[model samples]
Target: MGKSTLFNRLVGKRLALVDDQPGVTRDLREGAARLVDLRFTVIDTAGLEEATDESLQGRMRALTERAVDMADICLFLVDARAGVLPADQVFADILRRRARHVIVGANKVEGAAAEAGVLDAYGLGLGEPLRISAEHGEGMTDLYTALLPIIETLTPVDDEPETDVDAEEDPQGPMKPLQIAVVGRPNAGKSTLINKILGEDRLLTGPEAGITRDAISVTAEWGGREMRIFDTAGMRKKARVQEKLEKLSVSDGLRAVKFAEVVVVLLDAAIPFEQQDLRIADLAEREGRAVVVAVNKWDAEDNKQAKLNELREAFERLLPQLRGAPLVTVSALTGRGLDRLQAAVLKAHEVWNRRVATARLNQWLTGMLEAHPPPAPGGRRIKMRYMTQAKTRPPGFVVMCSHPDKVPESYSRYLVNGLREDFDMPGTPIRLTVRGQGDKNPYKNRKKSTPSRLRKHLGKGRADE
Candidate 1:
């Protein structure tokens, strides 16, 4: 299919591997691509091959499937010289089932070779295929035309038209900026909560649930931080969500979760331990985001102390994933415990964005190993040689060990839990990766060698000698 040539021309770099043989691209490769004025995420998938189970081709099929699922569109390349074959038909069928947007490329289309292949591809039922000699860079204009509509629909505009209504109504000058999204199940007082905090009619407060749709993002300042607060619609059980708009609103709220660094899961003080609330917290934990649990309308509770203790106990027992997350009680109507809520959010955010020094991490690792040595397997003591912080933004660590595979998952969990407790990294996801030590020592060649004559002269070497 000559993907390397086409990829080079599009990405303006030799990013994809080119070979005379077939099926070089076995995994998904993402690169920012530009066609004329349009820019979008381009994914290169393996050349779809037919294979039975328990074969290399089967593994390639699975890999390609995942890439197809992730891509917004698929640019399927077919060899023009060979024309569309049975394998191409099978590949086209697979793409047609999975990818919503499929654009076909008839490669090596020079002189008379392309005419029949281009016509043959239409039989694959993917509309008219774009014929281009990728090596010579011809017929790119046609390819550009095919991509324009896809880009317009999928990619969002850089700037939206400034609404005059917002300009006239919104206040001028500096304000405290905080972008917070209030999310929970129906009747969680998400909108009411925000209205009480802002002390205004910024959001429409009501008793009936699921009133808000399309996350209502409000710009304001809290303490000193400038914030954009978002009020999202109530999320409901999938079976109960009957309306199309409700599903869309739920998706929008989910998207808000990704954009937010700190998510405040509002809980009903009356029914605090709902399954939906637990699921929301789990989502935040899985996404490696900071989370704060707000028990709203707390003033209404009769046995406040008993209720708080019960809730905390339940949280520990049920949500082990968010073991050290903050649980703040607040009355949305009266604004009681508002300060505590703000403080909890800031602290959680700090933990989420925390970074650990490599030296400190190694020191901690050394202490841990000394206290509880790694278990011996088959009479061989497994040595965890060294540790390093491989990545941040949720601080991930890599442990170089004699046997990576032998390091049990239970032990990894122990280290992760310890990290949360010892390092003050609560309510944030921490990754511990175990890597087998390579065959060659990186520092082995760097040691200075003493000459034989010098060693002999010093061989009155020891004071005893």
Candidate 2:
């Protein structure tokens, strides 16, 4: 009953939205939790409910079931004040069958009023239920005790002696696995594509829209490189996302995009480049993430060549900010074009992490300024003196200029586009910042006092003396 409260207590922060009303949590929310000396990922899930397979509640139940399957241990909670209800028994049976490890918690058992319910929990055939008052912070010691053995077992034992080895043996070794997020509008086959990549039903997928509400991450090896893929909930237009749960789902998807190094904007070929799709792509670009556009449902299209041409044109016109980004046609349902998708993602990630040598950057800058000198706003010429790369992940640069603030945004865009074209970097966000010479010059505005003037002043003083 107080699952969110207990989750907040363990996580040491309020992450889940808790209310007196049931079903406030419709998605699985996870956070790194600490209990005394133990640390693990804790998931707060929706309250157990019974409904037909096609109902919305049933879909929520399916998500909870998936969470249970993913969990190492499930904390099955019951309302001790209300005793064991029939729904409690139904869900307890589910935990027994589905979950590998379960700890039954009798919540709200703060006083003698809950004693009878605490005893009744033992009859549910889950091991002895721990009486707990999640709101009052009770029974945590008992929880730590219960979890200690399991935690010790799960923790890997370092039996071998540590060896001294060079940590930075390879300067140009393989980079960390790319964190890729697949994002799109509702029913755009985000989950289907992920499932296809995983080659298993690791994620729950169906014909139903909004089936996925959580951003689930799974690791896979693709094309001889490891990849961490996030399968996020389908996003809808802001006006259409009126319900609270749907709003949370959309925010969760946005968070996935922010955490991602590369985002694959999956568009349905049947209805490619919708308004919502453009919004998602724009958001990714603003977040400075490498982007790859994948047109899904290619197998269902009758005129492949014409549709491909149309998609290319639409991509260039609708999202000019992400111009020259790889747009690959795919059928997530049929597993077609998956190799190309993976290659595009790798390429985008490479470009996203690209760095330019200072010499090369200045060379490019020289040519750019020669081609189109910066505008002289108010007739004050803006001289760009020097340019160097400031940082990489999205390739940020800083230019020393006579008047940095006076440099127009249009000129910055020109330089960014130039870099993108000259460096063969496409579909990756580029940043440029201008810095003014300012008062750094030590001799600026300094006047030289001639010897004659000094001698004249000195003579006047001598005469007064």
Candidate 3:
């Protein structure tokens, strides 16, 4: 049971995908783990399978071996509820040879049903197995005790005094990793594209529609930029997603989109934009994420120019909200057009984060007001006082005016489209909110008439009286 349950518990977040399906987690995920007073980096890997050839399971096994070789200590977890199986014994032998130090642990040992399995774990010859329940947070003290000594021995008690290196030496601070999430419908080459970017078969891919269940994340340096990329599960229609597992997978994908700064919506070359594809793109846009619509598998297309033009046309006509967003065509299979895709993503992110000066905003607003004056509704003029950028990273603006409530939706679109064209925001979601400046005197809500006692006192104090 090398599931990410313990990893999630230790990291204190549902960072890993969990389900009843075997091999749900096909990639290695690392997280900063905290065990009460102890802190360490934990790497959760795929389950150990006995496959040895070049099949998917075999590749997974090879990846796990790499993780084992790199780890200072390996915590080999076995399913206590299932008892010690032959596969467990075989994996134990492999770890003994490959891993430097191994600690055996029996996971899911919450009840008496698991006691026999815990006893059976002794046969692996990896020494005493800690009876722990990763889901219930049981036997954690015992686990803490087991790891304390090994951790102490390995980690130096004291090292060189740390310096404020970034704060003092570097003019600019550490670069923040750009958060990007690749989302699409089933079998749209999302994982394949990411695998090409990584230059490795890090994520499992096959002919199957939904081979990936978890929205896996990995760190990489792409196009000379550090990034944390999320590969989410394929999202199908809501009616089609009836199973519990699929629902969870879709939800995980959504959470990834929410966390990402740039959302790359991948479309299959064969079926460019399905109904589900539109929904996914709309979801990212509604979430205020910078959207980049990419058409994948371009190598298969014979009439490349025609298809490109058609896709661009469809993008504009379907998603006008993302009027200026970049639509790049790429082939994940042969890694064609990846450079263009990279440049497009970077440009989209730039536009998403671009902030305008208040003076420039006001100047642009004046031109817009002169071009199409706001309509006088009910014989009351809705004067737009001024405009200022309220925030960046999706670029929200506030327009102070006389009658914000009376502003027409069409006028709001006009201002938004103007911002996109004038400020070069393009495909990024721009938030334009109108806030009304008070119509009359400022103290309209205060008591208009004076209190009786106060008026009497004022009269008595008058010099004439």
Candidate 4:
């Protein structure tokens, strides 16, 4: 009943969102769990709603059953207050049939009221019910004791590598998957596109407006490259996002964007450039994440050339910040243009982390300055002494100059666009900072104390001032 809460407790982070409302989790969210001495992977699944049809609940139940098949040990949680229901019995039977090992837990057994439910759990035929308060963190010792033997039997070696399920790949080891966050408005085929990439239906998808609530991450190898993809909830305009749940979902999507190295803004081909779409792309750019604009549902487009031109024109006119960013077209349903999308995402990440040598940067800066000199404000020239890259990953550069505050935004844009063109660093966000070198002399602005009258007289006598 408290699956997400228990998951957060075991993982020691609030990775999954929790609400009084059920079905907040639609995907299989995995986390590396640590319970005292035991460390293993734990999955938070959707509520077990019994539906065999292709409805959202049916899909969720299927996903949970798949997880059961994959999982080594299953933790079956039943609400202690509600006691064992018919649904709980159904789940118990399924677990007994499919699961390799199972532990029945009577969750929310915090006080005297849940005692009967705990007793009811004994009839579940899955051995003793571990009474645990996932919300209050009680009965954890019992949980730990129940899981230890299973873990010991399953674990290979203690000295082996401590690998986390969601670990970002290390360049020193195997190939590191590129981190990608796919975002857009409601029903933009974000999940559908990811499912195409994974070659399986991992994320729930249908005609519903916003089925996804959490920022769900899944790993895959696409187009001959490894990738850790995050499928976030659809974001809507602030005015339309009146519900608390919608607000939470939008905020969660924004968090996924921040964590991503590249954000793919999925646009419906029918409605390519909505106002909210521009805002989403701009948000990614402002956060310094590389952006890719992808138009989905291209297979249904009749006037493909006209639409492409229109999309291109609008992309440049509305989002100049993401100028030269990749605008790809793909049909998630038909799975067209996936290779191009993959290539574009990888290219954006490469540009985001691109670094230029200081020597090259200065050389380029000198040429730029000669070509278009800094403006003279009020007959006083703004002297730009030198420029050097301060950091990469959405490359950041600093210009040392005199009266740097006077550097106009227009001129800065000129330089940024110039860098993007010359260095082939398109699409990824670029940060340009102008700073004046501070005065070196410690007492340049001060009066040097004027050697107060008494001190001056003493200096005249002893020359010690």
Spell out the clash pairs found in candidate 2: none
Better of 1 and 2 by TM-score: 2
Number of the top-ranking candidate, with lDDT as the measure: 4
Q: Which ten residues in a row have the lowest lDDT in candidate 1?
A: 173-182
Candidate 1 TM-score, true structure as reference: 0.57
List where candidate 4 sits over 4 angstroms from the true fold. Answer: 156-171, 441-443, 448-465
Which is the better candidate, 2 or 3, if ranked by TM-score? 3
Residue by residue across 360-404, what tens digits does model 2's lDDT show?
A: 988888898999988998999988888888887788999999978
Q: Where does model 3 exceed 4 Å of error?
A: 20-22, 53-56, 152-167, 443-465
**Residue-level lDDT tens digits of model 4 in 117-200:** 999999999999999998899989999999988888887666678766554555456667899999999999999999999999
Give candidates' CA RMSD values in order: 16.7, 3.9, 3.1, 3.7
Cand. 1 Cα-lDDT = 0.79
lDDT of each: 0.79, 0.87, 0.89, 0.91
Q: lDDT tens string, model 3, 1-465? A: 845988998899988877776777777778889998999989888878789887878877887888898898899998998999988889999999998889898999877898999999999999999988888888789888988999999987756767886678777887899999999998999989999999987787877788778788889999999999999999999999998888988999999999999999999999988989999999999999999999998999999998888888898898888888889889999999899988998998998889899999999999999999999999999999889999988999999998788999999999999988887788999999999876587776787799899998899889566
Candidate 4: the clashing residue pairs are none
Q: For model 2, give the 10-residue run with minimal summed lDDT.
A: 161-170
User: Residue by residue across 1-465, what tens digits does model 1's lDDT show?
Assistant: 887578767887655555665665544445678888877766665666688564656655766777788778888988888889998998888888999899998888897967888888888889888988888989889999999888788866767765688657767844445456778998898877777767765554556566565565665567667777777778877788886667767887887787777789999999987888888888877876778989998999999999999999999998888888899999888889988998998888777667788788889988888877888778777898888877765668899998888888878888888789889988777878999988786667587889899887788667556
What TM-score, over all chains together, does every model reach? 0.57, 0.84, 0.92, 0.93
